[model samples]
Target: MRTPPPTTRPAPPRAPRRDLYAAGAAVLLVTAAVLVGRHIQGSRHTLSVNWPPLLASWDPHLGPGTPAAVLVAITVVAYGPALAVRLPWRTLLPVAWATATAWTFSLALVDGWQRGIAGRLTTRHEYLQVIDRFHDIPGTLRDFTHHILLGSPDHWPAHVAGHPPAAPLTFVLLDRIGLGGGGWAGVWCITVGATACVAVLVTVRALADETLARRAAPFLVLAPAAVWMGTSADGYFAAVAAWAVALLALAVTGRSPWAAGGSGLLLGLTCYLSYGLTLVAVIAAAVLLLGRDGIRRRPVLLVPLLAGLAVVPTAFTLAGFDWWEAYRLLVTRYYQGVGGVRPYGYWVWANLACTVLITGLATVAGLRRSVSGLLVRDRLGTPEARLALLVCAALLALLVADVSGMSKAETERIWLPFAVWLLSACAFLPRPRAWLTAQAVLALLLNHLLLTGW
Candidate 1:
């Protein structure tokens, strides 16, 4: 007769994970950024952004692309995970790219053609404005640094002055090819930017495993980063940087020397695209470290890598563009504008809030798991740890940029290259569907509600 089995007592309600706490901390950071940034901006006018932490304004409305954006979001939310899992690797890469392009294009169209795409890069502060300035390519390259200062004769616009000539030159060459103006530039950016998702998946599969790569694919496609990627040249920069890393990953893991050379070529281009992007080397180093075993086997890969690395700089030098001199002038010009007044104290932390917006709340939790993976010494070479190290490297690069004080605000768009990598951390979380929904909602809400100035 016996004693009844002791009551199970429901396994004592599982406590919240450290990931949730980390995510909560991120939410608080965003809240504090809004409240504090509004006060600082409204009172002293120093923050320089209408919306705290983001270069956007509070304008909530729907448009022609609203339905398309909503539909794309739902499609990805429902089918993305399954397709990412089942599609052949080759087929999956292009499909992921197409989906990303659709997501980015639809979000851009939310603001309509002219305001969103066709005119974004034609503004006074944008690259297309200076296409004529680059007519005498060699001459402009030689004199590019002269115009970075605010007081210089015919000084470049903020965007032009801030980046190396390679960035604007991309547009110049496009114009020469008969695809001038903001519309073609917009198409170029979105198409190339969409490849960033594929590039990251390729790298993850190369360095970690296909399983993690597959899990991460949907998150990359439906990233909140798409909001900014749709309009900014930074999106193009992100793709370039991602491919550079992906090529390096392949090269280290037994691909052809061509892969190494391509990686180096893109690495040089990435640095020239935006000075801040020089930090991409941080991520590159992580990839190499993770792939050190492969590197040890084929030490000859570095030859082609170094050879290709010389191509851009040598050509730029021959053409008269001096990367160092240009950056020095740009730093001086930085303080001549709002960068001088936007307090670092507020921005240092608020910038992380911008990161949260770009990466979404899911990434906050995902990063927690990424960090935990790094803690176990024995698992350092395991797939989870490899991916964690890669994600953390991107985070480190972004943190360095934030501390450098140059990126005070508008970082939601400005940090797209680094922030895109953060989305990969989403692969570590359980309940992929819920996290994916959170990502989609964040992106849709941001696109529908705010007029972002990417």
Candidate 2:
């Protein structure tokens, strides 16, 4: 008789000493940011931020959305887990999106309509400030790099000049379609940003397995990161970047040529949306590595993906918008503006504090489990490890951005694209409702207590 080959199965998860300790570390980081940030802002006054780590101010109050935000939080915490498990896959995706949209909208409304929904993107620093300037579209594209430097004539606004033409062009197209003003812009951002929950769920299901995706759905929907995603253009950018990754997951797993093309299209656009999003390629690389079966015939997928990827840059380049030139000038402009004043020594660590506050305490503990899962040799092919790799890829990208020094303060909002993925760590947690409650409470407190500037 021949002996059958032995197999290794995933062990059941348990509470470890590291879980509590990891969470404690995150809390300590936030406390240190607050204490240290206050001292620097009070003395050197060079942080260029009102709320040390974050860009917001402290204003405790409530509004019409307070009850709704509380109710949504309660409902999600009380029922989201069970419902996530029970719902059909198709139904769950839309439900998650709707719930996330509601949560974001209600939280934004806590600051009321004008301050929250209708005015976020209308400020002097926002993309909307340059809509009229983009009326001469082709001309503007050719002239884009000319205005990137701070000393340039009629220098572009902070938001407009900091990003590629695609960022402001989005609002310009919206205005041309008759949805002008901050209300429409804010609505567009929230509605689209909320879809990121669905994208993450789909990617999780396709890349790892359905079980992990379902476990992650509630956390994705109830994320405190939605506080910034509600109105900021970065929220819109996060959704685009997320769908790019999701489509890439589908393409690599199923080896569908069409899916690869779509993924490529979005991934290219994601780069133009925000330079930092180029780091998403890190996560995409992880997906490719994990999808072993799909990569056997790499050319089948890569060809279409590369083709779709070329469309955006080709169009911009032909139109005379020099992406490379603009970025070089942007680097120089960065050092010339507030980027010059913000102390790298202070922001580098404090930014992680912003991450903890935005992602919530549940993620701290969840990430601890993620790292532990990675250390196991036998579990590399298991669903938990697959998820951990994805989460870690995102963490690596965020850390790279932090270390690059381009992202100092305002990371609470600026890091939304990466922060959304970090919430997926909650899938690794046990006693989900307990952790969900913590996530909910953290979000409610942050929104009601502090006024965010995103």
Candidate 3:
């Protein structure tokens, strides 16, 4: 018996999976080729009803190839983090944030201060003056709410008319602080860009493991979605929604009442920022129910979150206007405007194509692996599986948006929040560097070759 006890068999060695890496690289190259072809053809045939004229007119101040070359350089710099993945979390975090900020500024500030900042200000002011008559904050809110129910005598800013008070309230705050111009827009872009990166890391670490979070960091930093994060208010909206999910993640993992409340407040704020962001409730719910232990404590999380969400809207309701009614009226007004310009038939597929472009083709491969992982009973309860579920939730929300006809075009910016989650699918990529490169190429093509109003 003693002799038999000494006989322990040696473990078998694992096989190398180099083929997976090759497959990932191949997918990346093919995707990059497709995006390049699209960019060339798109210069001739723009899909956007609003920006067709702009796209058709080539106006690159940095010569024709300069934009592409600059983008390539930025893409190469953004890869620094992926190369340094083994570094400490503290070191990696700053690098990720810095690269993301630089990348955003590079794309956004391509035309220099005048065209980037002053020009944007001029456009905003003209639109504000023409559409809303250039009223003060209180006056603007009053008129905005009034026009929500009553059809305007004049054409109003579609964004102002459709969003809650919080949307324009942001500009009002900016004005009060003496920071109301295209320069401020650029500032907002950098601030939101950095915040989004942090929120995403926090959310990933909370929901999954630190290793996974670190792996996701580079992709988040160099997201193709930066094409819009530089100039769109939706960038700020993406940050807000991302933090909401992150706090919800914390609330579930730590079982903190305050975190739950904070999550709810942010979620409520997102609703005010954009009507469509209410769909993020799906992500919140998914986070709350992610782990087995967390399931029983869902009410503890939901109650505070709902209470926090109700606070601001409740005040708005008591002040004078009912948000529900305003949103209802907006439905009709929204369609009468862009809905007619951008048809559902074209935008439905086009938006999906934009998503593919924005998230990279490796995402498609990762998504397939995630789906397969989710389908297996043994893997169903793993963190990767739960995260995959979150990605699916975002995609499902996007599908609903495409089908609704409310979002005709401009989805590259509009889909920023969803794209954040889509990037999560990159976790399943065999070689993250390959996927990041693909994303960088796509962002370069989108920002440099194409002209978008956002």
Q: Give the TM-score of candidate 1.
A: 0.96
- Per-residue lDDT of candidate 3, residues 355-417 (tens digit): 766666666666666666678686676667777787787778888888987776667778888
Encode model 2's per-residue lDDT on 1-454: one tens digit a residue.
2222212233354464566688889989999999999999999999988877888899998988899999999999899998988888888899999999999999999999999999999999999888899879999999999998879999998888889899999999999999999999999999999999899998888888787888888999999898898789999999999998998899988888898899899989998888888999998888888886797866579889899999999999999998889888888999999999999999999999999998998898888888878998978888888989999999999999999999988898888999988989888777789888988888898888888884
Error of 1 at 39 (Å): 0.5
TM-score of each: 0.96, 0.96, 0.82
In terms of lDDT, the poorest run of 10 residues in model 2 is: 1-10
The order of the candidates by lDDT, greatest first, is 1, 2, 3
Ranking by TM-score: 2, 1, 3
Q: Write the per-residue lDDT of candidate 1 for residues 1-454, one digit (tens) a residue.
A: 1222221111112212666788889989999999999999999999889989788899998877788888988998899888877788888899999989999999999999999999999998999999888879999999998899999999999999999999999999999999998999999999999999999999988988887888899999999999999878999999999999999999999756999999999998888889999999999999889888777888889999989888888899999898998998888999999999999999999999999999998999889878877887967677888899999999999999999999989898889999888999888877678888999999999988889984
Candidate lDDT (C-alpha), each: 0.89, 0.89, 0.65
- Highest TM-score model number: 2
User: What are the per-model numbers of colliding residue pairs?
Assistant: 0, 0, 0
Clashing pairs in 2: none
